[model samples]
Target: MPDPTPPGPRAAILPAPVFTDPRVTLFHGDAVELLRLLPGASVDALVSDPPYGLSFNGQAWDDAAGFRESIPHVDTTAMSAPEVFEVWCTEWAAGALRALKPGAHVAAFGGARTWHRMVRGLENAGFEIRDQIAWLHTTGMPKSMDLSHAIDKHHGVQRTDRIVQTSEHDGVLGATRTVLSKGTPVTEDAARWEGWGTALRPAFEPIIIARKPLAGSIVGNVLSHGVGGLNIDGGRFADDRWPTNVALDPGQADALDMLTGTWQEGSMSRRFPIFRFEHKPAARERPRAYGVSHTTVKPLALMRWLVTLVAPVGGVVLEPFAGSGTTVEAAAGAGYQVIAIEKNADYLPLIRSRMEQ
Candidate 1:
C-alpha cells in the first residue's frame, strides 16, 4: 500500500523508545509515518483495530467530532473526510505491506458497515483477499435513531411526564392504553413510531483477513521468510467435528448428488468450524469510553487466540492502531514480539498500563 503522492519531509525519529518491554515497543506517532521507518519485508504479521469511521460518540480519536463533543464542530463522522479516510486506509495498508515480509497475513477489526471500504483499500494496496472471519457476539447497544422523540420534537410537544402503558378501563383501542403519564395525549404519528426503530441490532463484528502476495510458491515463501500460511494446526480445534454437508438442506444435498452424480470422499473444498462461539460474555453491552479512553477493548482471550492463529511462535507482529495495547499484551503472552503504534498521545499511558497488566 505504497503512497502514490510525492513524499514530503519525514518526521524526526527520537533517540530512544517511549515504552519498551521484553516483547513490546510502542511508538507515539502517526502509523503511516512510523511505518515508513521499518525496512520493507521486515514484519511477520499485523493485528490491529483501526477506527471504524463511525465517529463513535464524537470521540477525538474516533474522528467523529473535532477535539471534544461540547466544542462546536461540523459533526464529522470519522476523524477526517471520506476521501481522506479512504486514503488513510490505503496508505496504512501499503505501509503494512512494506513493513510486512512477503506472504505475511493481516487481521484487522472493522465495523460491519464500513469494513468493505477497508477491504477494497487493502486489495487495492496489493494484498490478497482472504476469508473474512466473523467474531460472533451479542451487542445490545445500538446507534439507531429514536423516531418517537423526533416526532415529538417535530410537533413541538413538550411535557414532564413518564410513558405509562397500563390496562385502563375501556376506551382508546381496548383496555390496554399507552399514554404519556398524567393522561397526556400523543399524536397518531408519535404513537405509530413508539416501537419502531431504525437499523438492525448489531450482533457480529467482522475481522477482515488478508495476506501480502507471496514471493513464490507457498513452500518457498515459508522456507525463505518463515512467513505465509496460517498455523492451521494451532488454530484448529481439539474436537474432530468439522464442515460437512449438513449445512445444506437434505433435498438440496440430494439434488446436488443427482445433478453432479454421487459425491465421493474429499469432495468438500475446506473444513468449516463446527463449534460456534455465542460469545455471550464478549457481546454484552458496555459503556463507551470517552476523552482519553479507548472504547473498544478486545477480550484478551480472543486476542491471544487470534495471535496464535495468525503468527508463528516467536514471530514478529506489527499493530498499526494499537489502542490500549491489547494486541501487545496478547502478542507477548502468545510468545511473539510486537511493534505497536498509536497516534493520540492520550492513550499512550493506557496502552502502557494494559501491557503492564
Candidate 2:
C-alpha cells in the first residue's frame, strides 16, 4: 500500500476538538476552514447533507444572508441566485477534495429544487459525477401556498365555514403540533383558484454520488488506496439481492409491495425489497439526553448504508456539514474513524452528546 500524504499548510493549525474518542472526533467551526485544515488525501470517504440554499423554514445557515434573492455587490447580472449558490458549493467542495484520498466517494444529499446546482458545483470541483440516488419517503410535507386562500384574503372575505386542524409530527427538530389553514376561500376568484397551490408535495431527496479522480486503473487503485470501488457485497440487501439507486422508507416500500407485488426465485420468496431505510431518527436511533434541534437531520440508517457502500474497512470518514452529527454517528457505529465538523455553536452539544453515546 502507498503511504499517506503529508499535511498541507494550516493543517496543523486546527481548532480545538470539542469532542473526541478513539473512533470519532468532532470540530465546531466553518466547514471550508476546517476541511482545508485536514491532511491532504487522508479521508477515505465523505457523506454530507449540505445546505440547499433554499431558506428552508427560514433557517439562517441555509439562507446564507437571503441566498435565494440576489444580494448587493455580488454581481447577479450574469448569474442568478441558484448560480451563486453553485459557486458557494464549489468553494467548499474544493476544500473537501484536498482532504479526501484519491478515488474516495462522496454521498451528498441535495434538495429537489436546487440539486442540479449542487451537482454542477461538485463537477466543477474536480469530482467525477457518479450515479444519483433517490430516497423516497411517504412523509413529505409540502411548503406550498394556496392561491385560492390568498385571493380570499385579498378580497377581504371571511368564510363562515372554517375548520381548524392540528397536525403533530416528529421531525428532525423534535415533535411539535402545527395548526393548518384557519379557513377556506370565500370569494368567486378564490373559488376559481381553489385546490391550487404554489408547490408540489415533496416525496424524495436526491443524493449525488461523486468520486475523486482515481490514481490509476480500478484494480490498481483499490489495491493501493483501498478505495475507488464500492463494497457491492457488503451493501447487499437482507434478501441477498444487489442494491439499487432508489431507496425507500418503510411506508414507501410497503406501498410499492402492494402495487407491484412480490417475486419468487428458487428457495427465496420476497417482495420488492430494494434498499429500504431500515434506520430512522426514532427514540432508538437518537440519544434521548439531547433534544434534536437540527432542522435537517437525515435518517441514521441511510447514512450508515452510504458510508459502508463507499468507504473501505477501517478507513477514515469525513462529514463537513455535520448537522446533528448523523453522518459521524453512522460512520463511527459502522466501525470507521470519523471526523465531524459543524459551524453552529448551538449544535455542538448535540454532536457531543452523540459521541458520548
Candidate 3:
C-alpha cells in the first residue's frame, strides 16, 4: 500500500489551553443563540447548572423564616410549581441538549422537585439518563415539617408555619441542652445543634448525568444493568433516589482534613484532591448581594474531577451556561480544551478575568 498521508493539524489532538492568556471566547447574549452558532459534535463533555426558575435573587436568607419572608418580594404566584419546572426542563434544557456531542455527558445540577421532570424531558429529547450523582453541599436550610402537620391537624385551615416554628424551637432547645450537658465550647459544639431535624435539614441537590447517543447508530439500552447503565456505580435508581435526599451538612472529616492545608499554586500534582474547598467561609463569600449572581456555583475542585472523568486529555469541554466560568477554568486546569457560553453580559468580564488568572 502507498504510504499513509500524515494527519493534518486540524485532525491532530490539540494541546490543553493554558490559563495564562487563555482564549476564553465569551458570547454576551442568550445561550441558545450562542449554542446555535457552534458546530455540532465539537465538544467532548457538557456541564452546567441552569436557572432552577426558583428566582432566588441571590439574597442571603438568615433562615427558613427569612426565605419565606422574601417570597412575597418574589413573583412565584405567577405560575404553578409544576409549570415552572416544565418551562426549565422542556424549554431551557431543550437548547442545552442540542449543544452536546454524541456519547457526551450533560451533568445538570437541580433540586429534587424538578429532577423527575428534567429526566423525562431529557429522555424525550433522545438522551439517556445515566447516573444521578449527589452534590452534597455544606450550606443548606432546614426542611419543612408543614406537610406532616397539615396531615395531622384536623383544622380545615392547616397552619403549617406554626409547626415549622415549633420544630425550629425544639432543635434550638436540644442543641442548648447538649452543650450544657457536655460542657464543650459553644463555638465548637454549635454546629451539632443545626443537625438535620424534621424542620431544618441540609439541602440535597441532584446532579443528573445524561448522555446523548452517538449519531448514525441505534441507541443502546441505557437502562441495562451494566457498567454504563443508570446505576453504573451501584447507587439506587435515579427516579427513586432524588439528590435532595442527600444532606448538605459538612463533608466527611477526612474530606475536611484534606482541605485544611493550603493549595499549592499551579501544581497539577494535587488534581482532584478529595478535600471540600467550598466549605471554607471565605471561599463561599460572594461579591454581590443579589442572586449571589452565581449562587449554585460548583466548586472548582468538583468541576475538575467531573471534567477529568468524562473528557480525555486535550478533549473539548463545553458549558452552555458558563456562570462565572467555573467549568471553563476547571477544564483548562485539567488539560482540556474548553468552550464556554454565558447569556449574562454583566458576567463576561468576571469570566474573562478568572480564565486569564
What TM-score, computed on C-alpha atoms, does each candidate reach? 0.74, 0.86, 0.57
Superior candidate under TM-score, 2 versus 3: 2
- Global lDDT of each model? 0.69, 0.80, 0.52
Residue 333 CA displacement from its true place in model 2, Å: 0.8
RMSD of 1: 10.5
Measured on C-alpha atoms, candidate 3 has an lDDT of 0.52
* Among all candidates shown, the one with the greatest lDDT: 2
Which regions of candidate 1 deviate over 4 angstroms?
A: 1-15, 64-80, 163-185, 240-292
Off by over 4 Å in 2: 1-12, 66-79, 165-184, 261-274, 278-280, 283-292
Let me know the TM-score candidate 3 reaches against the reference structure. Answer: 0.57
Model 2 C-alpha lDDT per residue in residues 122-206, reported as the tens digit of each score: 9889999889999988777778777887788798876666654544766555454453654666788998998888998888899
Worst 10 residues of 1 by lDDT: 242-251
Q: Write the per-residue lDDT of candidate 1 for residues 56-76, one digit (tens) a residue.
A: 656566563322332232233
Estimate the lDDT of model 1: 0.69
Q: Is candidate 1 or candidate 3 better by TM-score?
A: 1
Top candidate (TM-score): 2
